[model samples]
Target: MPHDIISGDRHPEALPLAEKVREEERARIARDLHDELGAHLTGIKMALGLLRESLARAQGPEQPLEQARYAEQLIDEAGDAMHGIIDDLCPPIVEFGLAEALQWQSRMFTRQTGIVCRQRCGDGLDELGEFEVITLFRIVREALSNVAKYAHAENALITVERQGDVLTLRIEDDGRGFDLASAARNGSGLGNMRRRAQALQGTLQLDTVQGKGTTITVVAPVAR
Candidate 1:
């Protein structure tokens, strides 16, 4: 068994850092909503307007081929918007425990992207404090998103377990990994994960070997 730290006794800095993380992620979510879903909805609205206009012109009950085609397009757009918004909300946080959520996502990702995803999580994580859980989830989520986008991987693995007083989460991929030292010049994905981990006074280790694979590990004090 491990000791537990409650809110009032946690490291004083953790609260401020957690607040920063909440703000940062929330801002990122808002921006994504405005750019992705907002764009899709706008397109859908325009398509509906065209449909209405075509109807006003007595285009018949069957409607014109172009309008039907556009209607289908609008439906697709709406689906995409809904998916984006749901993703922004972090669907995994709700459907399953954090570990199980990641596994489910990995399976879905593999089916959609043709990459093998493996997951293993140990016990005790389910009882972690709320902030610890949130921060850890964000870090892993950001790492995997990067993998899906950048890593040319055929397979990936995510493992979570507790070691002594520390809880660790890792995301590893057999892909064309890049230089860890150069991450400072890369996209904001890794940076976001680092920030999220730091907010919890946690440590993030990003290990990558070009032509091999990349591994990102996060560890935070379970006792804290």
Candidate 2:
């Protein structure tokens, strides 16, 4: 959502202010939905179930039974939708910790895309702050999304490690690489990835060779 992304600006150090703002807003909404809306939805579902049981016991009239059935169906649909929104807003990542989250994501990706994704994350990553944890999660998520959309590769790998004060993440795919210039011209995924890496006061390196593969490496400080 940054101007650089839309205008195809390729400055490495530029931050995606718009994208960051969007992410922050997303986090806030995730919290509110899960805490407020989610609770309400759950209560509604429970109430509907109780009402259905009451109707069954009382031998309610046919008209009321039909309406209750309709209402229960609606509540069930709404509950499912609410769950999806909450998951998107605040994934199951934080609950399981970063390393496990990455592993789960990788396995899900492999299952979904049939593109073998291997993950090797070192220990102690669960100790990072929330900001660092989510940032790394988003980085890896976006990287795999790109691979799914553009990589056309059969296998991909993700590596995470801690070295001194720095935390490093690498995503590599043996796909049909693209022209750097052309990719920069698209200015969406690549720009967003770079902006996120730079936002953490980290560095991102992209290596791609046509007909070979692409590797994205990001290194950021592990905030205490």
Candidate 3:
């Protein structure tokens, strides 16, 4: 008789399969946001534009004009928010390579959070696969997010370099560092970054000193 039994072992293919599934899901959501919600928002904006024009022609009450302008502003803000969400889910890797993407992310981080952020990337990173590029991008994003939220950092740097067949990515911040043990126990962001590195068959290290700074290093084998 054949019987099924539970095992304490994990399948070797599980990690890659799960990663693929997640990527596909993110892509789908991004596409939907870009296509469906984006279209609806655009339509609303156009309609508002027409309403404003009509009100201007009629020379109606000033209050109505003000209300229309306010509604238009709200629609614009929503459109911007939607685009930001889409970009986060699926970055424009096709348009910009890994290095360019990292640089753009640094600029955007500084602009949004008022923190000085910079990036230095070594050559040969343009040849990395999409999976590696996206994974590294995500790791950097999460690290920067932590820096912004908790680090009280005045400056942050993202550096990427390749040595032999291994790629090393570092996010360093001059800020008040936290206890690694306590963060590990309380922070899901750190765990998420580690998992992303593990998905690439890499290792993640965190170095932090209280009242000094913090550095997160991810070393992963470059996919040949």
TM-score of 2: 0.76
RMSD (CA, Å), candidate 2 to true, equals 4.7
Q: Pick the candidate with the highest TM-score.
A: 3
> What TM-score against the true fold does each predicted structure earn?
0.68, 0.76, 0.84
The C-alpha lDDT values of all candidates are: 0.71, 0.80, 0.84
The alpha-carbon deviation from the true structure for residue 9 of candidate 1, after best TM-score superposition, in angstroms, is: 23
Off by over 4 Å in 1: 1-76, 92-95
Candidate 3 global lDDT: 0.84
Q: Which ten residues in a row have the lowest lDDT in candidate 2?
A: 1-10
Q: Where does candidate 3 have its weakest 10-residue lDDT segment? A: 1-10
Distance from true location, Cα of 50 in model 2, Å: 6.5
Cα distance off (Å), candidate 1, residue 149:
3.1
Give lDDT for model 2: 0.80
List model 1 lDDT by residue over 143-205, tens digit each: 777788888999989898987778888899999987655655656677667666666667677
Candidate order (TM-score): 3, 2, 1
TM-score of 1: 0.68
Which one wins on lDDT?
3
Tens digits of lDDT, candidate 3, 36-135: 9999999999999999999999997998888999999999999999988998889875347789989889998999999999999997797788878888
Error of 3 at 13 (Å): 5.9
